[model samples]
Target chain A: MNALLNKEMRLSASILSYLFIGFGLMTLLPGYPILCGVFFVTLGLFQSFQSAREANDIVFSALLPVAKHDVVKGKYQFSMLIELSAFLLMALITLLRMTVLADSSVYLQNALMNANPFFLGVALLIFGLFNAVFIGGFFKTAYNFGKPFVSYIIVCFLTICAAEALHHVPGLQALNAFGFDHFALQMLLLLGGALLYAALTWLSYKKACENFEKIDL
Target chain B: MSIVELKDVCKTYPAFRLHDVSFSLESGKITGFIGRNGAGKTTTIKSMLNLIHTDGGEISYFGMPLSGHETEIKQRIGYSTGTVSWYPRKTIRQIVDVTRTFYRSWDEDAYRKYMTLFGLDESKKPMELSEGMKVKFNLLLALSHRAEVLILDEPTSGLDPFSRDELLGLFQTLREHGVTILFSTHITSDLERCADNIIYISQGEIRAECSKADFLKNYGNPGETLEEIFLRLEREAKS
Candidate 1:
């Protein structure tokens, strides 16, 4: 399994994926839809998938001395690794925003989503959605990725819009709280998001294995 | 002893189907899997390797069912297709580094020997090699793993006559080392050069399976070449 993951990084991974991890720093941006950073991270993963397909990575892995399901597992592991790395970076930025940077006028006056636990939670949900929609859809055929990726893009943007809109709703203003103002509730959302990410990713990996098994190639 | 066996194997698509395909490969011999394009050669090979799921049938390697033993079975078997475009940007050293980790039986000495014999540059990527060199590279990886059985699909396709002959000679060398080989190709001359057995498929069905001499004696007249016999069989199938 470790070998397969290494193959994914060295052989199948596009350089853009590593570069795109930097997008997580966007959480520091004021008045911007910070969740776009999550979308870009996933987009970077999508490029890796596209390049891998072009290079016949699946066929190569299939020929290896591993089970078909292991191939799916390797891919999911690689995706999760990238997603979590970006998430951790974003988490660090959010911590900074909630502490030392809390009183910065640029952030305090920002009308968009704030860099807080709630935002990180929403980002986790977006990551889950990508695992479910894009990775799951990709294994159905294992070759055609354009539709799955486009679908993920649409779903992610819609998620971003919803996350941005949730704070404006009456009584839900704490969902966007900054500087530990609603610390307890924000932590709960973060925990829920983590659970959802794990569930969605596991389910996606299972479905991808089943779908890939049915494919002739 | 039979190194690989398939019984009543079947796979279906909307446009084509592999109908109860069955054959057994003799240990330590070259078996040419002859079939025209779209005649299910690749499908049959893929099914044997469990790369594609079979609809109904049993495939066994070394007398054990392939179902629960895929990893073990594949560990001893090496598979390569005609085109070697995979990981076009990764150097040969990088690919080998990853591949060697999968097999517990991997032989570094053997790998170094083949790499040197094939004159493969460790720094060169797949796209940098010529078609013949690409095939040799694939063979190098297989041999490095100490694979007991090598299943190759159209490995000679698109090669110049000299390169094709060179590959045929390598196949013979491997066979002499007691390595079981299943070489799939539409090229009859390749079979004539190295194959001791022949398993012919036409229209997704096993048309004939016998020793090379027996196949020729049964299917060919005094002057009929294997290609001529194949064309005749294909024509007969259509009619």
Candidate 2:
């Protein structure tokens, strides 16, 4: 398991620079936290899909003395680790911009409060669906490179757009108003997102492992 | 007793099929797997290690089913493919660092010895190595873990004579130390020099499996080589 993780870390290390650049750009997207949400969604899912493009890494991992299940599990866990790191970074940046930067004129403080946990929850949901589809697709053919990345981008764009639009829905307006005003409800919403993320990640890992077993390597 | 066994192993694809292939590698012996190109040698090797999932068959190593005991079985077996399937950008040191973590009993001193013997520079990336050097690096990774069985696929396909001779010599040393090896190659002469057991596979089936002396006695004139016998057998199969 340690070997698999180390192998993935080395293989995906090159992509880290892209993730950092994307994260920086997203943070600077003035007043729009949805860009940050999209950034995390894309990076979390791109890590595995990009690694799958390198035949060397898959073949090398297959040759290792680990179970197929462990291979899938390690990759899924690594993706989540990256996603969690991005989430923390975004949270820190938002907290600073809201409190320290004290940019009262910027619209981000208002949007962040109104959306509460919806952005993060939707980000988690988007990545969950991405893994379930992308890993299954990769293991099926074992070598198509571009379609998965394109599919993921489309999914994230559509989901983020929908979540952003929800801020204007009349019926959901009361819910958002309640969420923004009540600290406990906001924490509850975050907890719900965390639970959903945990469940979907586990389900994706299971499906990937099952799909991987049937592959001929 | 056989160290590796394959019984009725089969795998199929759109372009090719491995049909009911069966063979066994004896403990403490060098088994040469011979065939022409596209003759299912790599497929058979992959099936044995479960690198490719067999559609129908059974494989066992050291008396246990390979499917259930893959991890434990693979720990004692070292493998190399025809092409070096490794990260091109990683230096030799980085490759070793990742691979060594998988095996609990990895011998660092033995690994370093092979590194020194092969004159492999730690700073050099895989893309910098010659074909022969890549093969040597694979062998070093295979041998460093104290593996009991070695399965190599076309390990000497295109090498200069000196490197081939050195690799063959290393196989002999490993054999003397009681390590069983099964390596596939089209180079019949390499087998004639070192292999005591011969398994000839052609077109996804086991054409022949026997000891070298028995094969020579049955199929060859006193001075004729295994290559001559192999070509003759292949011709007969086609007809």
Name the weakest run of 10 consecutive residues (lDDT summed) in model 2 chain B: B81-90
Clash pairs (backbone) in predicted model 2: none
User: What clash count goes with each model?
Assistant: 0, 0
Q: Give the range of the ten consecutive residues with the poorest summed lDDT in model 2 chain A.
A: A173-182
Docking category of candidate 1: medium
Best by lDDT: 1
Candidate 1: Cα lDDT at A169: 97
> Each candidate: what lDDT?
0.90, 0.74
List each candidate's DockQ score. 0.76, 0.61
The residue-by-residue lDDT of candidate 1 on A29-114, one tens digit each, is 99899999999999899999989988899988988889878899989989999999999999999999999999999999989999
Per-residue alpha-carbon lDDT of candidate 2 for residues B1-239, written as tens digits (9 for 90 to 100): 89889999999999999999988899999999998889998888878766687899899999999988989987899997657647777788888888889998799898988888777888888788888788878878888999999998878855679878888998999999999999788889999889999998888999889999988888777888999999988898899
Model 2 segments beyond 4 Å from truth? A17-28, A44-48, A96-103, A108-115, A174-180
